[model samples]
Target: MKKWALFLLMFLLFILLACNDEETNEHVSSDQEEHEKPEVRTTPSESSKPKTKPLPEMTWEHLVNQEEGKLTANLDVDEKMSDQLVETLEKEITALTDETNDPEQIYRGAVDLLASSYYQTYFEKASTYDPDFEEPYLPDPEIEKKEGKKASPKKAFILLDASSSMLLRVNGKIKMDIAKNAVQRFGEVIGQDSDLSLLVYGHLGSESSEDKQLSCEGIEEVYEMSPYDEETFQASLNSFESKGWTPLAGAIKEAANMSRDFTEDVTVYVVSDGVETCGGDPVAAAEAFTKDSKERKVHIIGFHVDETAENELKKVSDAGNGTYYPADNEEELQDTIQKRWLPSLADLAWAHTKAPGPWEVLGKLEELEKHTNKLTEVRQLETERLNTVYRLIRDHDLLSSEAREDLKALLDERDDEIRTLIKNLTDEKKEDINKQADDIKNRVSEWRDRMYELRDEERDHS
Candidate 1:
C-alpha cells in the first residue's frame, strides 16, 4: 500500500511539471507573435485624414460675369481702381492662354481687355462734371420798342501762336501748315459780314535767345477788327512764319487793350502749341482782361500739347472763365476750331442783343451748347471705338472660330451698353438745351416789354 501511494504522488508531480512547461511555451509563443506582428501599433485610417477641396474651374463666362459686376457698380469718377481691374483681367487672360496655344484667341482676348479698360476710364472722365442747367432771370414782354439803334456788331480775335513748337511735324504734316489751313477754313466759314481779326505772335524772329526780345515784342494785329475779308486774311496768314519764343501773355495783354476800346462783345481765341515762354503771367493777364468786360471771354486751344503743357494752358482758360480745347492732330485741331471756336462766335453774335439781360441769358445758353457739343464728341469717339472693334473682328483673321464667336457675343453686349449710355446722356443734354432755349425765348420777349416801359418812363419825365 505504501509503494502504490508513492507511485500516485510521482505521477501527479510529473503532470504538474508538464503543465508548467506548457505554460512557459505559451508565454514564449505569445512574445514571438507580438514581435512578428506590426508592433500592434495603431495608424490613421484613410477616411480619418483631411482631404483637399478642388478649385473651381475657371472659364470665359465666369470672367465676363466678374467684369460685368465690377463695371456695373456705382463708381466715383476719381476712383483709382483701373490698375487693379486691369491686373485681374490679365490673370484671367493668362489662364486662357495656358489652356489654348492659339495666337488668334490670345490676341482677341488682349484687345477686348484693353477696350474694356479704356471705356471704363472714358466713362469715369465724362461723369466727372455736372452740367450747368440753371435758368437766368427774365424781364416783361409787352413794353414798347426802345427808340435806339441795334447793338454793335460782335468781334472775334484769333490770337495765333507762331512759336517754334508749331513747326513740329504731326501726322507727317507741319503743325503750322495745319493751323494755317484751319484758320483759312474758319475765315471762309465766318464769311465777309462777320467781324474777324488776326493777332499773331512770335512771327518776327528766328527761334533763338537773341531773337527772344523781338519775338516778345512780335505781337501784330495782322487783320484789324473789321468785317472778314478773304484777301486780307489770306495775306495775313501768309505774312508770318512759325518762329521764336511764345509771347502768349504779351499777345493777350495787347488783345485786352484792343478789346477795351471796342463797343461790341469780343471773343479771343488763343491757339497755342505751348504755354507762356517769355516769363509772362498769362492767367493773370487773362483774368484782368475779362474783369471789367462782361461780354469778353478768352478761349484756349492747345495744339498737340502733352499733359503737362495742357494743364498749364488750361489755367489761362480757367482764369478767363472759358473752356479749354485740346488738339492732338490736324483733324482734332480742325474739329476744335469748327465745333468749339466757331460755335462760340455764333453764340456771341446771338448774344449781341441791344438789351443787357437778354445778352446775359444768351451767354448761359452758349455754355450749355458748348457742354452738349463736348458730350456729342465723346459719344462719337465711343461709336468709333465700337466700329473699330467690329472691323477688326470682321475684316481680319485675328481670331479662331471659337474665339471669334465668343468675342463677337461679348462685343455685341458692350456695344449695347455704350449705346444705351450715349443715348441717355444725349437725351438729358437735349432736354437741358431745349429748356435753355425756351428760357431764352421767354427772356427776349420780356426784354422787349421792359424796353417799352423804359421808353414810356423817359417820355413822362421829359
Candidate 2:
C-alpha cells in the first residue's frame, strides 16, 4: 500500500510540470510574434537618418508676385513647419497620453521620417539624386500640365466701407480698424508698375452737390491715404476712421468711373460688412460697370458681416463675375484678402482679357460682327436648350409650321452672323470664335433628339 501511494505522488508532479512548460512556451511565442517584421524589411543604419534638403527659399515680395494660379509657398509658420515643431508637439502629446514611453516624441519622429522620405522621393523623381546616394528616393511628379495660361497683372482701385457699421466691434476689435490693417499690407503686394488708389466712404456728410461729387474722390487729408511713399501707405492704415451711413451703391459706381484711366484690366475691390443704406442697387451698379464690355471684373469681399447682409454682398460679387470671400474676423480677413485677392489680381493682369477694343479704331463694321458672332452662338445654344424643354411639354399637334419656320429662320440668322464674323477675325481670334461655333453645334444635336421625342409623343396621342 505504501509503494502504490508513492507512485501516485510522482505521477501528479509530472503532470503539473508538463502543464507549466506549455504555458511558458505560449507566452514566448506571443512575444516573438509581436516583434516580427515583414520579410523585406531590414534594420536601418544608426548613422543614416532620413534627410531632405530645404525647399527653395522665397522672399515675401517674390512670393506675392508669383502668377496667381501658381502654387505659392507663402510664409505659413503654422503647426506643420518641420521636425522640431513635431518633436515639441510630441512631448505635449506624450504627457497627455500617460504612456511609460514618450509616445509623443516617437510620433513626431515618425512624422519627420515620413516627410524626409517624401522629400527624397521628390528628389529622385526629379532625377536629381547625388552620385554618392546608394538608395536614392524618388517621388512621382505631382502636377503634370505646365501649359496653363497665367493671368495678366493690372492696377487696382480698393474701396473700403468706413460707415458706422464698420465701427461695430467683432472678434474684440472694430471692423474698420481691421480693414485698415489689411490695407496697410497692400504695399507688399503691389508691383512697381501697379498703381493703387485707396477710397473710403461715409467718413463725412456733405450737403453740397460739389462735395458729394468729390466725395468719391474725396481726400480727407490724404494723410497716408494715397501711397505717396511706402511710409505713407503703412502709416495711413493705422489712422482709418469709420462714421455715418454707407452710400455703397453710389460709392461703387463713382469709384468705377473715377478709376477709368487705370489699366483696362482694372480691379475694383469693394470691402464691406453690411447692406447698402444709401438708395442704390449694388447689383445693378456692378452689372452696369461690368457691362462696358471692356471693363475689369469687380470683386467684393464681405468681412465680419452679419446674417442680415450676406446675400446682398454675394449678389454684387456674382453679378460682376468676381469671387466673394467671407472672413469671419480681423486676422482671417487680412489673410484672405491678401493671400487670395492679391494673387487673383496678379493672374487677372497676366490674362490680359481686355484686348484693345475693335471699336476704338473704327476699322470695319465687319470686325464688329466677330464679337456679335460669339454673342449670337451663345444665345443660339441657350435658345435651343430652352426649346428642348418647352417642346417636350407642348402638344405637337398644336404647333404650326409657321412657328417652326420662325425659329429655324432665327437660328439661320445666328449662323449667318458667325460666318460673317469669321471672315474678318485675325487667326488667333478665329480659333476662339470657332470653339463657340462648335458649342452651338453640340447644343443643336442634343435638341434634335428632344424634338423627335416630342413629335413621336404627339403622333401617339393623335
Candidate 3:
C-alpha cells in the first residue's frame, strides 16, 4: 500500500513540471515574434497639413519702425510745440527719415514725399503741356565692329588724399583710415576687366612750411593702371601716411594726363578732406581735363570737410562735369563710392553695349519732371505748415512776453532755414529736370529721324 501511494505522488509532480515547461516556451515564442516584427508608419493626409501665411509688404512706416531711434534723433522739432501737432508731424516725417540722417537721405525723403503727395497732379499738368507730343521708341544702338584685336579695358584713376587734415578724427576714426578702408572695399568690388590706377598725394613730408614744397610734389602713382592686384594695392595703401599739404591740382593734372592715352572712357575719383592747400587751381585743372577728353569725368569726394571746403570741392566736380559727394562718416563714404562712383564706372565700361535708349531716356525725363513738380509742392506745403504752427503758438499765448520774443526769434531762424532748403531743392530740381529733358528730346528727335530714314530705305528697296 505505501509503494502505491509514493508512485502516485511522483506521477503528479512530473505532470506539474511538464505543464510549467510548456507555458514558458509559449511565452518566449510570443516575445521573439514581437521583436522580429517591422515597424509600420502611416503618413498624415494632405488636409491635415498646416498652411503658411504670405509675408507682409514693406512700407515707409515699416522702414521708420526698423530705424526708429536713428531717424528720430536729428529731427529739428521744438519741445514747446503742442503734443498733437508734434505727433502729427512726427508721423509724417518719420517715414521720410532713415538710419542715417545724412543730406542725401533727407533730400531723397523730401522728393519721395513730394512724389507721393503731388505726382499725379504734376504728371497730368505735364501731359497737357504738349498734347501732340508722342513718346519715342528707341532701339538698342548697334555695336561697332572691333578690328582684329580687342580694345584695352577702360581705366579708373583713384586719387587718394593723404593730407594732414585727413589725420583728424571723425566718429572716433581717423579720416585717412576710414578712406583707406572704403577704397579697399571699392577695389575689391570693381570689375576685374577694368584697369585701376591709384595715385596718392600729400604723403611725403611734415606739415611744416619747409616740407610744403616737398609734399606738393609728392604725388605718386603707387598702383599703375593695370588689372587689379589685391596684394599689390594693399601694400601700396600701407606705404602711405597722412602728413603734408594737399596737392589736389597736381594729382588731377597727372591723372588726366595718364588717362589721355586711353581710347576708352576714363573715370577719375579724387578723395580729399579739403581743397588745394598748395595754392594750385584744382577747378581749372578739372575743367582742362574734361575739355581735353569729353569721355573723362572727374568725381570729387569731400571727406569729413566743412561747408566752405565742400563748396570749394564742388567747384572742381562741377568744372569736371561730375558729381560732388560729401562723406562725413564711414557710412556716407561707403554709400558714395558704392552707389555713385561704382555704378558710374560700370555704365562707362558698358556704354557701347548698355547705354539707355531714347525711350528710356524720355521716361526718365518724365519721371524727373514729375519729381520736380512734386518737390515744389512739398516745399510750399511745408512752408505753410510752419507758418500755421507759428501763428498757432502766438494765438494760444503759449509763453510770456520775453519767452514769446525768444520763440519768435527761433521761428524766424527756422523760417530762414526752410527758405534756404527750398531754394536748394528748387535749383537742383530745375537744373536736373531741364538737363534730362533736353537730352531726352535730342535723343528722341534723332531716333525718329533714323526711323524715318530706315523706312525710306525699305520702301526704296521694295
Q: How high is the CA lDDT of each candidate model? A: 0.65, 0.51, 0.65
Tell me the TM-score of each prediction against the true structure: 0.41, 0.38, 0.41
Residue 32, model 1: lDDT of: 95
Model 2 residue 337 CA deviation (Å) reads 1.9
Residue-wise C-alpha lDDT for candidate 2, range 8-68, written one tens digit per residue: 9999999999999999999999999888945774445746645545432323223223232
How well is each residue in 1-462 modelled by candidate 3, as lDDT tens digits? 999999999999999999999999999999999999999965456586444443223332332233212222333322223466555544544443323223323333322332222323443454334322322223322211122322223778889999998899988878898899788756654534468999999999989999999999999999888787879888889988999999999999998878766787787888999989999999999998889666678889888888999999999999998889898898888766552121233433433333345565466556656644553564355444444433443465433455446544644554465445445544555556456556656675565555456556657989
Segments in model 3 whose C-alpha atoms lie over 4 Å from true places? 1-153, 339-462
Quote model 1's TM-score: 0.41
Better of 2 and 3 by TM-score: 3
Off by over 4 Å in 1: 1-153, 191-193, 339-462
- Candidate 1 residue-wise lDDT, 228-325, digit = tens: 77788899999889888898999999998887778777778888889888899999999998898767778899999989989999999988877799
TM-score of model number 3: 0.41
Candidate 1 vs candidate 2: the TM-score winner is 1
Clashing pairs for predicted structure model 3, backbone only: none
